[model samples]
Target: MFNTPGNSKGDFLEQTKAAREERALEKRRDAAAALIQANVRGWLGRLKFSQTILNDIDEIIPDVLDDTDKLHYKPATEIYHQALKFLFVWKKERDKERFAKLCRYLVASLDSDCPNIVMLVYL
Candidate 1:
């Protein structure tokens, strides 16, 4: 069966049938492999993009908190609020430390003179 010539017509037919089934199985396997790879790439891309966004947020947090009287402060505050909500909701095991550090930084950076800002972070 393994490379030897078939001894009869029935043997040849059986050999061809097995080959066809093997080919179909290989096709299915290839399709599954492709799908798995695509999903993994998408997950990794999203994880990296999320990290980049967090870094950008870290850079702007001080500005958003310090300039409350500016016209943009209101919108920035709203964005900051949303970010806090996101951070608090993030439940990934890998990011627990990062989230905690961000929370600590936010708490420590608050200005006592601005009760609103203080309350916003606490909330």
Candidate 2:
């Protein structure tokens, strides 16, 4: 709160700055996901899920799955889905000694078994 301007317009500027920061954070997260997904997609083939599905995947899946039977049609659960337990595993390979070594030593040979289930080795 230090050095904040003491005026009504200052409040508006502060709000705008906060909004811009939020947007930048969103962009960074999206970019990070895109890089991971791109590397994954190239390795796994075209992502089985649609952008529409991926776009709202986080928010909509919860409501869509509130009724268990409704999820039957979803590709991740219903089709050639042995590899994808869920979408991505953020456990991070580097966090686990075995995985970290594998990621470092054998990552070149390690391609995704399922395009959808990405174990992010690092962000």
Candidate 3:
């Protein structure tokens, strides 16, 4: 029980049994703590800024893909087209308003002549 040497065999056996029980209880406590953490908001407040980051990524992807699509290589253009298709659907489902805003922003700048219409048509 105490830090001193045990005089009785029964005392030593009891201490070992208690130690094992303590270890098992500690493991249970840790598992419960992790489950509680999974239910909590998070240290960083739900990471709401992640939505903005997603929007930012959405805003730039089309221009990058368009540039790649211009490169004339068959495989590269096909892959770029595939990525564009995926992003378009994802943005629509996740942040449709932001998608519309970005589409307008891109279009508003290029609405002058038929030349720009060609670009819009490609998109």
Each candidate's number of clashing pairs is 0, 0, 0
Q: Which stretches of candidate 2 lie over 4 Å from their true place?
A: 1-6, 46-123
lDDT of 1 at 20: 100
Best by TM-score: 1
Which residue pairs does candidate 3 place in steric collision? none
Give lDDT: candidate 1, residue 26: 100
Off by over 4 Å in 1: 1-6, 63-78, 81-123
RMSD of each: 6.7, 19.8, 9.6
Ranked candidates (lDDT, high to low): 1, 3, 2
Give the whole-model CA lDDT for all candidates, comma-separated: 0.61, 0.45, 0.52
Give the candidates in order of TM-score, highest first: 1, 3, 2
The model with the greater lDDT, 1 or 2, is 1
lDDT of 2 at 24: 100
Q: Estimate each model's TM-score.
A: 0.52, 0.31, 0.41
Candidate 2 residue 59 C-alpha distance from true site, Å:
44
Q: Give the per-residue lDDT of model 2 (tens digit) for 1-123.
A: 555556667889899999999999999999999999999978665444433334343332333222333322223333223223223432444225423333332232224354443233434
Candidate with more favorable, higher TM-score: 2 or 3: 3
